[model samples]
Target chain A: MSELTGLTLKAALEGLAAKRFSSEEITTAHLAAIDASSALNAYVVGTPEKALEMARASDARRASGQAGPLDGAPLGIKDLFCTEGVESTAGSMILRGFKPAYESTVTSQLWRDGAVMLGKLNMDEFAMGSSNETSAWGPVVNPWRQQGRNADLTPGGSSGGSAAAVAAELCLAATATDTGGSIRQPAAFTGTVGIKPTYGRCSRWGIVAFASSLDQAGPMARSVEDTAILLRSMAGHDPKDSTSIDAEVPDFASFCGRSVKGLRVGIPREYRVDGMPAEIDALWEQGIAWLKDAGCEIVDVTLPHTKYALPAYYIIAPAEASSNLARYDGMRYGLRVEGDNLTDTYEKSRAQGFGAEVKRRILIGTYVLSAGYYDAYYLKALKVRRRIADNFDQAWQTCDALLTPTAPSAAFALGDKSDDPLAMYLNDIFTVTVNLAGLPGMSVPAGLDAQGLPLGLQLIGRNLDEGTLFSLGSALEKAADFRARPAKWW
Target chain B: MAIDAATVRKVAKLARIAEPESRIEPLANELNGIISWIEQLNEVDTDGVEPMTTSVAMGLPMRDDVVTDGGDPAKVLGNAPRAEKSFFVVPKVVE
Candidate 1:
């Protein structure tokens, strides 16, 4: 790998500004790294030609002293975001060969800030699975493996490709989406930093929707500062998405070095679930001690509805997914299979288009929303959703932010939990409550597990209060000082 | 809320997915497992809680009833599976 590929997003920006390296050099290096690392299956499509063109333009702009904040930075976009004229498949066969005509609001913002797109990263089909095994292209392989084991492990999903690419130094950073732990869990699995901003912090226009009410876009990078820098460029209000909050985007980079003194961090008791690994518990204790040593107060807070979050999410997300996916019928765009009648055509197209997991979710969704079951399943889940949010709302009175584990365990081998849907859903137990409550949550790489894989600590902040999480995240990053990188096997 | 093969077939028809006769029983069993797992939500006491349709409490934003930026038919039909001129081609509905 080229040394330029190893530079952090922050370092790359400084290098571009200082004239130490031209934007073309950095872009070429990352493109080459991506080409060499194809075995990892991180990128679904590689845009080397477009990247070079963008790099040249960024260099010229820098020569004229008009460089944007992310000028010359090479980044990977998740396939979930629709890139204008690029084949944006949300990692499903249904959207195979469909090239979107318009750009997503999030990717357009990154380009406007002068970032170069290396390619579209892989993900779970429509951001549904906890592991990337659900992707049509293929599951992404984690760069890290156990000490003596050669079995391939998942990088986590639905942002698995983003996590793998960043961990393998294929890109400086990658854009990821989190409907429910999609961003944070993958980041934890890959030893990267990911933040799912408070609901509507970033516009959802043009991004593929999994669950409209729960979906949000965020960034994944190697460090807290890099994530903050990318997030500042990615977040803002857009009139196109009605759910977007018309709030001012803060300068997130400035909060990276801010003090955490006098801050009250909450430790939610419900996260300590049965059968959790010992290393995860120890890491949580270590995180608490780290915060306490940094002059912050730690308090035990209770989120009574946390246990019900997973069940509620499974209900609400699939219900919304069934509705959102209804647009993929064979007529307008994408794969089409003709049948004897229009309804048969719809059935054949969908049957051939979706994977098993997606089909299952759609079936569950249709069942729940069916006339006789709507009130019993869908409405009841909504009520539980309200209680989950209320628990978090009440916690804010006692603490500035809540701390917990990012996932139940470290990244497991591919196909380990694919057989059992409920076992797979349990992967998001610690992270889903934050999404249900519509708060900003982040995962910072904290320590390594007994098997030598990475473990992360999560911080849940109040709505529209991502600044506090950034401060606390950087503090934890400093204390953890986790510098281990996966050996180059790809 | 145990989903049986009959209910699974009903849902597959409603969802418009071509599930084979052989897959129905297995699909029903899998869905039943998930449904049983989610049935745990009924244990919670939600007496007067309002169903949350959205996370943020904001009214839907409306715009003036005027055309804004979509007129060309070629661009709209660019990705269509089958299109002639400005119209999408589908199987004949009226026979």
Candidate 2:
């Protein structure tokens, strides 16, 4: 595990290509590592047999001189992505014993690119909660410790397992979906890199819908280059996913070493929220200084609608979720109940299968979308969402990208905010606005909290401008010098 | 801001979930707390802002409104609790 940590994705692939180590060996090591790190609870289901089979095929392809860029690399699939012949639960019991006959375009594309499948990782049930604690499977523990703090803390969510896996070197990279900060939040918590590309940049054909309007899948990895390597393989249009963009993807790797000199970075004045921890503030200041050192100009900008984003997101996300989830009517790919009547079966199946938090969200979603309440709740939230996007539009005029803290603070204790939904929702405030605006965003570890847990700074780019975001993120990662290894590993 | 037990029960029914009356009070309290917090949005004035339905602004594609999909009814009903050949098996409705 120690040897696996800090190895760049490109280097690892090259090592495999050169036969310095076989893909089978790497896959075996990762499988053993996952077994050893069972206490972390990073995985929901591990498919070592399938991983070895994939690795053997990859090695065979390489021997035949036909290998892809991500050849032989082991990657974890987030439970949210549907894999043909594998159970895709989205972390809910409702989908227990359910198996999809089709693979998500993204998952299959990765397979075509020669990456080995590690297993399905854990997540928040139906991608609803900010902390993985809401998962029917259980919470994922952060591998990093908070100084003398002996108790385990959350790895963040709903893509916590993906982040934790990459951070602990359980896998080189993992697929993660972001509706409102699922990818970036978990990355920040685990001190790794996570990117949420522009909306529609990646296909969502077979990914389970949480909030269809906002959900987008992206890469999580140990370094910016690893993210670029994986993103190139994952991005592009698919006719199966009508929402996926058909635009040509720029060579993202080429931008990694390109100078950030003369780039304009915007600092949103409204992001300096009340009660923000001093450590987070100081880390943000340091990030701004790094941009300044890179010969970039900084200007103050205002997103006046910043405070309204959380409420708007809460309403819109749930409203969409309710509509999308209606497909799972106990007669489809999920739960089914035994009852004397049709309506009773539907009622009983849903009641017995869904967890408390998931049902609460469905209720909230339904309430906001009810016949009499649509205008006041759902429509009004949509209005605010636009204003928030407009705020970004105004700021982009003065800057190429916007800079802020990824979260208010670093990862908190697992049960710290478990009792308070509002407090948990606040953790996503800084990251959600970018999603609402349809822009690209990335999280880079900046420094450590007072208790030594890692803090991260986020960078937001213009829509479809992932190349710029990764370039800036890579440069910042190199300059920040805030490397903190996980406190424990399998 | 305090939602009563009856309101919680009513909302659950509207949402199509069945819950016992005993659990309604706690659900109501939690719902009240969350809704009251969301009420903080009332302080902001968005008088003229247009609602944003999707982050990417584009018109949804419309089809010809003709019937197009129907196949493998048996496969579709395979996961149902009870199905007979190609149709979902619901209790008989008429006497």
Candidate 3:
């Protein structure tokens, strides 16, 4: 049962489908695991009834020969993704009473593909913080820590709960979104495999928009193969989402093979920033060495505009976030505050509903878009963002894929950089460039730090080339041989 | 790096979030710090650099000029703080 803690999504799905284990049994065990590890704060709300209902439905589907590829697998969904009739607060006080009447396309598709929904996991309020500490619900603890090394380490964010839940074995896999390294960073912190597919690979309809153009929903799982399977089920066109690509959803599972014999991997020279922890630098080198040993060619590539990414992303994402979040005014959706006048109502509603960090971004967002400043800030940022994407396009021509550290360092302690919002923003430095480029990216657990915290190696693929990313990520994961488990859980 | 309290107040008003006088100073200070952090961009010469906006390389699609939406007024206003018959109620702006 303890070893089953590390079972990949592929094994779990096959076991459930073959009746080697029942969905009821799997859900029960995971629920028990979740209950036992409540200290991790991985889950915002647990829905045993929902999980059982979905599991029973999955079993029925299998009995009736309707099992999909994801049949009977248990998955955790981040609170940011609205779950119909379930509390979907996005880890904020503002949405305390909020409930969506419609299911997010990603959540509905997970159930339709026969996966069990364990519950909504915790995250930063409105997905704003690099550390989960900004969550109105409180921070989620990283599972992998040695006794006496530190206390309450972050599982990264704003998808910390999903990563923690999967890392702690509360669920086999979890749904996550990456607007600016939300998915990949948390996966890096918690030692799980997380992928942010091409911008339009997954439908964002009904998802609580953070940064509409940058936000992408993907999966975090125990292995690259597991992540690939979840991505396949999650990807495809949705007429409801105008941005959802109409491209053919490839059999991502088929891409996982031992051979990368002639593949070219580009090591971006600019991503190796000053002050990066030595362990992270070494891990990147080890990852490169592994690829080299695997018969892949390594070449130095330059994304000259890399330094501009973080600043540009901050401006653009918040600008879009401010606009997207404008819908939350006391008029429609989410919490409404009563006031003497309509304007007061919107003011009170937003003030009471949003947390400090959310308000900060909104203000920053509004400032950049303000009159006389729009052209200097927002428009300028947009142009720099394009150059960053162009840099990636130039690199892809020289190599099949790009590689870098998912983050400058492994997970920092809870509240380590929480006081400094700029420090929090800097944590996404390595991951946000992919979002700006609208490229596909994945984080695979590369190695462990001195304290045994997980280190992640990121793989960047060309637009809509998730197949190649998965293949390279899986090949690297096999060679790394890094397996992680939460210290106090079992 | 410190921004003026007045700027913070103005930004708070634009954002529609209430910030007390005591909080305004700290908020302005924080915003200034973040602005300074982002000021790292000034060091890099973006002489001819074009700003990237949307990550999607292709153009955002525009639907045909047809009445495609707008029938669920009730549902839309169901969560409204104050609504009148078929409309959201608001304070009068002018006499």
Clashing residue pairs in candidate 2 (N, C-alpha, C atoms within 3 angstroms): A382-B51, A382-B52, A383-B51
Interface DockQ of candidate 2:
0.53
Interface RMSD of each: 0.6, 2.1, 2.2
Q: What is the DockQ of each candidate?
A: 0.93, 0.53, 0.56
| Model 2: docking quality category | medium
What TM-score, over all chains together, does every model reach?
A: 0.99, 0.95, 0.95
Could you give candidate 1's per-residue lDDT for residues A230-287 as a string of tens digits? 9999999999999999999999989997999999999999999999999999999999
As for model 1, its CA RMSD to the true structure in angstroms is 0.7
- The window of 10 residues in a row where model 3 chain A has the poorest summed lDDT is A1-10
DockQ rank order: 1, 3, 2
Clashing pairs in 3: A94-A353, A382-B51, A382-B52, A383-B50, A383-B51, A383-B52, A384-B50, A384-B51, A385-B52, A386-B52
Please compute the TM-score of chain B alone for each predicted structure, in the order given: 0.94, 0.82, 0.84
Judged by whole-model lDDT over C-alpha atoms, candidate 1 comes out at 0.95
Supply candidate 1's per-residue lDDT for A471.
Answer: 98
lDDT of 2 at A170: 90
Model 2 CA deviation exceeding 4 Å by range: B1-3, B61-95
Error of 3 at B89 (Å): 5.6
